[model samples]
Target: MYQGIYGSSKKHESDLDHVINRAFKSGVEKIINTAGTHQETIQALELCSKYENLYTTCGYHPTRCNELNESNEDEILKQMIDLCEKNAEKIVAIGEFGLDYERTQFCGIDQQKRYFEFQLKHLISLKKPLFLHNRASSQDLYDILYKYRDEIKAGGVIHSFDGTLDEALQFIQLGYFIGLNGCSMKIQNNLDVIKQIPLNKILVETDAPWCGIKQSHASYSHMNTQFTSELVKKEKWIAGKMVKDRNEPCTIIQICEVIHSIRDKKESFDELCETIYLNTKHLFFSDQ
Candidate 1:
C-alpha cells in the first residue's frame, strides 16, 4: 500500500521512523512528508533514505516565512534546492508552505508574499509537485496560483481541504488534487462537503501528530461522566467520545472509513485505495 504523510517536524521527534516501521509492518511502503526548515528537510532525507519507503517535500512554513530572510535562509534554501536537484529521485513535492493568516497575523501579507513567491519560484524550477496549506487566505493564495498556473511545471495538492464545494472546484480546475484527512470526518457540515467532492480528485492523509478528529463529548466525560448529575447530563452525550491518537500513520484507515461512508458504497475501498495510489504515482513518480 502507498500512503502520504504530511507535516513539518524537527529531529529527535521525527515521527517518520515510527511511521516507516508501522507502514512496513502493515505492508505499506511509501510516505510523503512535508518539511519545515532546511535542517529538518535534510534530517528527513537521511531517515527516509534509510527506510526506502519514505520521501519528503521541502519548504518553509507561512508562520516561519520570516525565516526566509534570515542569514541561514539562503544557505538553507540553496542546500535544499541542490538536494532536490541532485536527489530528485528521492523528493516527492515542494511544500506545507502557503498562507496561514489565522495563525500568522504578525508576519503580515508582504512577508508571506515574498516568501511564498520565493518558494513557488524554486518549486517551478525544481519541477516537483507541492503540498500546500492555506488557512483563511485562500483568496490571495488562489490569485497567485492562478497568475502562475501555466508556468508551474509540477502541479500539487491542497492539504486538509476545508473549503466549500465551490472553492474545492477552483483548485481542481488548476490540476491540483484535494487532500482529505481526519479533519473532514470531524465536522458535521464537512460530511456533505466531503460527499460532494469527486473521488478522483481526492487523496487521503492523516496529518499525524496533529489534526485528528475527536467526538467532543468523549473528552468532557473521559474523567467525570459517571460522577456528573443525571439532570445535568442529557440522554445523549455529544461533547467528546472518541479521541484520535497522535503520530501513527496506520490510522490512515480512519480517513478511508470517512470516504467509504460518504461515497455510500463499501466496494469502493479497494478501488479507492488503488485510485489514490495511482493519483500519487502519477503526480509524483510519473517522470521518475
Candidate 2:
C-alpha cells in the first residue's frame, strides 16, 4: 500500500502469500487488505482468496473517488458492484471509504462526499461491515454513516483511528469498532485517547509501512522483534523487516502491547488481546 497513487504499478506476485503465512505463524489469525480502487480491490481479493487466513475489503477511498470519471462513473461503479456481487464470499467489508479533508488536493470534498454516500447506500445490499476512514472529517463522516446506520447493521471499523476521544466515543456509541495502529500511539494525547477506549470496542492494525510505532516509544523494547528471515528476503513483504522501519503485520502485537499498557484497567492483558481479536473476527469474518 506504500506504492504510489493507484498502486497499479505494483506487479510483485505471490509475495503477499508469504506475508500471510508469516502473520499466521506469528499468531495472527486473519488479515484484511483494504482496496481503494477497482484494480486494488480485485488484486486484494484475488490475493486474499489464496489464503484462508486472509480477507479483503472492496470500496473507493475518498481520495481516489475521482478515479471514476463522470463519463464512466455509473458504468465503473456498476462494474465494482458486480464484482462485489460475484465475489461477495471473498469480500469482507465495503470500505476504506469516508471523508478525508486532509487530501482535498487529491479529490474535492464534494466529490469525496458524493462517492462516499454512494458507497454507503449500496453497502446495505452487500451485507458486510465497513472499513471506514476519516482524517479531519469525523463530523461529516459520522453524519453520513449515521444516515446509513440501519443498512450497515453488520457494524464497521474506524481503521487507523487517530481521532479525539469524543470521536471515538461517538463511533462506539454507534456500535462501531475502532482500529488502532502504532501511529495512534505516536502522540501523548492519542495515547490518552486510547486509554479511554473499551477493550471490546477496539482492534489493532499496522497500517503497515505507514503507521509503524516509533522506536523511541517506551514499549518498543518489549514489543519489538526481528523480522523473519523468509520475510526479510522478500522485497514486497508486509511489515517492517530487519533492514528498515516498515510496518509489518507481526508488529500488531506491539500495538497490542502498547495499547494494553496504556488502556483502561478494565481487563487483563490476555483478556484485552482476546477481546480485540474476537472483535475483529466478528466484524470482518463473522460469516466464517
Candidate 3:
C-alpha cells in the first residue's frame, strides 16, 4: 500500500505477503483485500493473482470521490471491470465503495453520490458481491443498493459495520451480511448490537493494519491467545509473527474472541468460531 495520505512513498512490496502468511498460520483460511482507488485496485489484483488464499475487491472509495469524475470515470470503471472479469476466480468482489457523509467536505455529497451510483450500476453487469464501507450515509447507501438489488447477483457485505441495530436489521432485510472488525466491536453497545444479529449473517475481518481491538467491554484476561494485553505497550504490540501497533491479519482471532465474550452461552467456543468462519466463506467465497 502507499505509505502516506498523499500516496508518495511506497511500503515494502512483500509486506502484505508476510502478514498474510502469518494470518493463515493463526487459523485464518481466507482474506478479502479491499481496493478503493485505481492504484489500490491494481495492487490488490497483483497480490490476489499471486496468492490463492487472498481475494480482492475493485472499486473507488467515497473518500476518493474527487479522484473519479467524468474525466477518469470511464477508464477507471473499465480497468476495474476488466481485471475483475478476467480474474473472476480470484478478484471476487467489487466494492470498498459507499457513502461517507462525515467527509463530505473533502468530496461534495453530490459528487460522491454520483460516483457511488456509477460503481453500483457498472458492477451489476459484473455480477460480483459488493464489499461496502458506509459511514454516516446508511440511508443513501441503502437506497442505492435497494434500487439495484435484483441486478446484484452475488449480494454484498457491509464491512466494518458501526451502524445502529435498526440499520443492521435494515441491511439484513436487504440480504447483505454485516462485517465486524475490532473497532466495530470496541464498545458495549457494539457488542449488544452484534448480539441481535443472527450468526448466519455475521462476518468477521481485521480491517488491518487499522482496526484492532481498541478496548473490549469485558477484560481480555480470559483471552485464550498468548498475545495478551501485557504485550500491547500503549503504542506497540505483537501478536503471532506480525509485530506493530497497527492492526494485522493475525489478530483476527482477537476479533473472534471479543465476539465470543458477548455471544449467547448456548454454543461452545469452537462451535461459534466454526459458525462464523463458515458464514464468512459463504459470503466471500461461496461462488469460488
Candidate 4:
C-alpha cells in the first residue's frame, strides 16, 4: 500500500478508504504495512495508529540500503529501535530487510550484505519476528539468518518467497514460515515449490499493490474467481474504483483459492484457509 496506493506520492489516495474497507469486508482481519526505509517505517507506524487492526514493520529494504553509511547507520539503527520500543504494540517485526541480489544496481552486493547483517545483528535483540526479503541471494541470506537463528526466538516469515523447494525446506528447518503471495506463484516452479510447503508453516499475503497475479502467471489457471470491483487505469482513476494492475488486499482470496487448487485435495478449502490463518497468528500475533 505504501508504494502504490496510500503513500504521499501515490495517485490512488481518493480510493484509499474504499480499498481498505473492501479488504475488511472481504474477510481480511488484519493488515501489516511493511516499511522499506526509516522514513516509511515512521509513516507506517503513524498510519497504523489511525486504523484498527493495522500493524507495521521496521527496517530498511536491501535495495534502499544505500541510505546507510558509516556516518548515519548508527543513528538510523537507533531510530528504528526507538520506534519499535515506543510502539511495540503496533510494530510486529524487524524487516522488509534482507538481500536482493537481482537489483544490485540500486545498492551493490557488499552494501546489501553488510547492512542486512547489520540489521539482523542489531534488531534481533528486540525479540520481534522478522519480515524478510530474499531474491537470488538465498545462500548468503541463509548463512546470515542461520548465524542468528538462536536469537530469533519469535521466528519470522520469508515474505513473498520465490525460492526452490530445498531452500524453502531450509528456512522451515530454521523455524521460519514461508509467506506466499501473488508473486510467489508467477511460474510453474514457483507453484511446485509452494505445493510442497507444509500447511502449518505457510502464510498467505497480497504483497499489494505490487504482486497481484497476472494472466501470464502459471497459477492463473487455478484462479476461476475474481473480485468484482471496477478497474481503471491509474491515470484515469476514480474514487471507489480499483486501479488496473494495482493489487489490493481484497484480492488475497484469489491467492488462497489458487493455493487451494494446487495443494493436496485431502484438505478442504476451509481447512487450508484456517491453517494459513493460524500460521499467520502463530508467527506475528501469538501474544494476542
Candidate 4 per-residue C-alpha lDDT over 17-69 given as tens digits, one digit per residue, 9 for 90 to 100? 78888889878999999899989988887778788888999998999999999
What does candidate 2 score on TM? 0.86
Top-down lDDT ranking: 4, 2, 3, 1
The top-ranked prediction according to lDDT is 4
Model 2 lDDT per residue over 136-182, tens place: 99999999888877777789999889899999999999889999887
Better of 1 and 3 by lDDT: 3
For each candidate, what TM-score against the reference? 0.81, 0.86, 0.88, 0.95
lDDT of each: 0.70, 0.77, 0.77, 0.88
**How would you order the candidates by TM-score, starting with the best?**
4, 3, 2, 1
Where model 4 places Cα greater than 4 Å from the true spot, the runs are 1-13
Model 3 poorest ten-residue lDDT run: 2-11
Cα lDDT of model 1 by residue, 181-285, tens digit: 766556666777878788788888878656654546211111111212311111222222211234346557667666766667645677877888788788878
RMSD of 4: 2.1
lDDT of the structure predicted as candidate 4: 0.88
Clash-forming residue pairs, model 3: none
Report the C-alpha displacement of residue 240, candidate 2, in angstroms. 12
